[model samples]
Target chain A: LAKTTQPISMDSYEGQEVNITCSHNNIATNDYITWYQQFPSQGPRFIIQGYKTKVTNEVASLFIPADRKSSTLSLPRVSLSDTAVYYCLVGGSGNTPLVFGKGTRLSVIA
Target chain B: DAGVTQSPTHLIKTRGQHVTLRCSPISGHKSVSWYQQVLGQGPQFIFQYYEKEERGRGNFPDRFSARQFPNYSSELNVNALLLGDSALYLCASSLVGGDSNQPQHFGDGTRLSIL
Candidate 1:
């Protein structure tokens, strides 16, 4: 399993773009970066995932550099409902459960 | 389709007692994983089962045990519970192929309060 580092908290206004970066210097060859959004009292929801370069989905986008050591999750036009803790995970194997870090709490203020 | 479902949304127990947490995976999902989330912290993996076999285990002690049923439901059992054992128990389900890119679906979780 690869360890990940991320900001503890972030503040952003509505309609702004928020980017949260994660560092995984020891990322394995088979490791893939995944981001999840967790609201209060609910399970974390999958936002986006990427192996390298950029991958966009309906909810968010994930960008990974060639080194695979770091990645960022970009959320566009945020709203108050977007306030939640974001988790970055690095794992890829058969039935290997995801290991979560402290996660960055993003507060989308009005 | 319904997402992962956990039973007994909330439970209260005393120390030295045993507790059982149940999880029913989504339809067609063959893999189920368990996690423990303490307040103000991210969830920690406990176990993973696929095709009714144990596929992975976390660093938890032997007091934590889990098994998957034929229908892909899972149960997490903890014996001799301590005060520190109070937390939210989460269950996630995913489709397990040879690849590891499968996204997991999680449930609302079972909140266990130990006194």
Candidate 2:
């Protein structure tokens, strides 16, 4: 399983963009990076995923460099509700279990 | 459509007792996975079952076991529970198995407290 490292916590003001980066130096060639957001008492919700370059969705954007060693999750115009923990996962396309690190606790203040 | 659903949102147990948590996958989903999340920590993988068969197991001890039914639902059973076993038990389901790239839907989870 590929291990990921991210910030322990971050604080952002409301209406500002938040970018959380994760490092996976040992990521495999077939591995993909995925991001999820978790609110209190709720399961982690999928935010975005990308294999390389950039992938954007209605919720967020994922930017993966060509080296695939790292990726960043960008949330535009964050609100107080966006205050939650964000996890970045790196894994192959197999049945391997997901490995979640401590994750970055994002606090969006109004 | 309804997302993944878990039974008994909250459970309280005592040491040496046993407990079983249930999960129902989303419509058309065939894979269900179990995870344990302790306070201030991310979830730890427990088991992954696909098509009613075990596909993956985590480092948890034998006291932690799980099984899937023909309908793609799953149950996680733990015996000889210790106080350290207290945590939020989560269940996730994906449309297919053996693919980590695919997004898996998760349930709110069952809060189990060992007394």
Candidate 3:
């Protein structure tokens, strides 16, 4: 299992692109990077996942460097509704239990 | 198709009491995992069941136990609940249990309050 470090909180204006970076210096070769978003009273939802390079989805984009030690999650044109806690996780396999950090609390202001 | 569903959206329990939380995975999902999220913190894994078998267990105590049914639904049982047990219990289901590419879909979760 690999641990992740991210900012505790961030403030962004609506319509701006917000990029949150996570550091996993000890990431394993087989580990995959995944990002999840959680609202105030709901379970975390999967945002995007990637192994290397960049992967874009309808919700967000994940950028992983060649070293795979860190990744960034980018939310485009963030809106007030995009306010939530974003978590970055590294795991070897699906059956491997997910380990979550405090996460980055993103506050989108209009 | 419906997403993962948890029963009794909210629950209240007293200290030393037992509580059973139910989770119904997505239609074709065969793997169900349980997590506990406390206030101001992220979710902690409790257990994962695949094909009615236990696949993994977290650092939680013995008081936290879970089992999956034949239909892939699961029940998380907690014995001798304490005030610290008050948190949001989440259930996530994935298409397969061993594939990292398959993301887990989560439910809104059941809020358990221990008083």
Candidate with best DockQ: 3
lDDT of 2 at A33: 89
lDDT of 3: 0.92
Q: Which segments of model 2 are wrong by more than 4 Å? A: A92-94, B97-100
Q: Candidate 3 residues A1-110, lDDT tens each?
A: 89999999999999999999999999988888989999988989888889999999998999998999999999999999999999999982556678999999999998
Provide the fnat value for model 3, as a fraction from 0 to 1: 0.64
Q: How many angstroms is residue A105 displaced in model 1 relative to the true structure, after the best TM-score fit?
A: 0.5
Predictions in order: lDDT: 0.92, 0.90, 0.92
Please state the error at residue A50 of candidate 1 in Å: 1.1
Per-residue CA lDDT of candidate 1, range B1-115, in tens? 8999999899999999999999999898899999999999999999999999998898899999999999999999999999999999999999877765887888989999999
Q: Extract clashing residue pairs from model 1.
A: none
Poorest lDDT segment (10 consecutive residues) of candidate 2 chain A: A91-100
For every model in order, what is the iRMS?
Answer: 1.6, 2.1, 1.5
Every model's DockQ:
0.67, 0.62, 0.70
- Per-model B-chain TM-score: 0.97, 0.96, 0.96
Which CAPRI tier for candidate 1? medium
Model 2 clash tally, residue pairs:
0
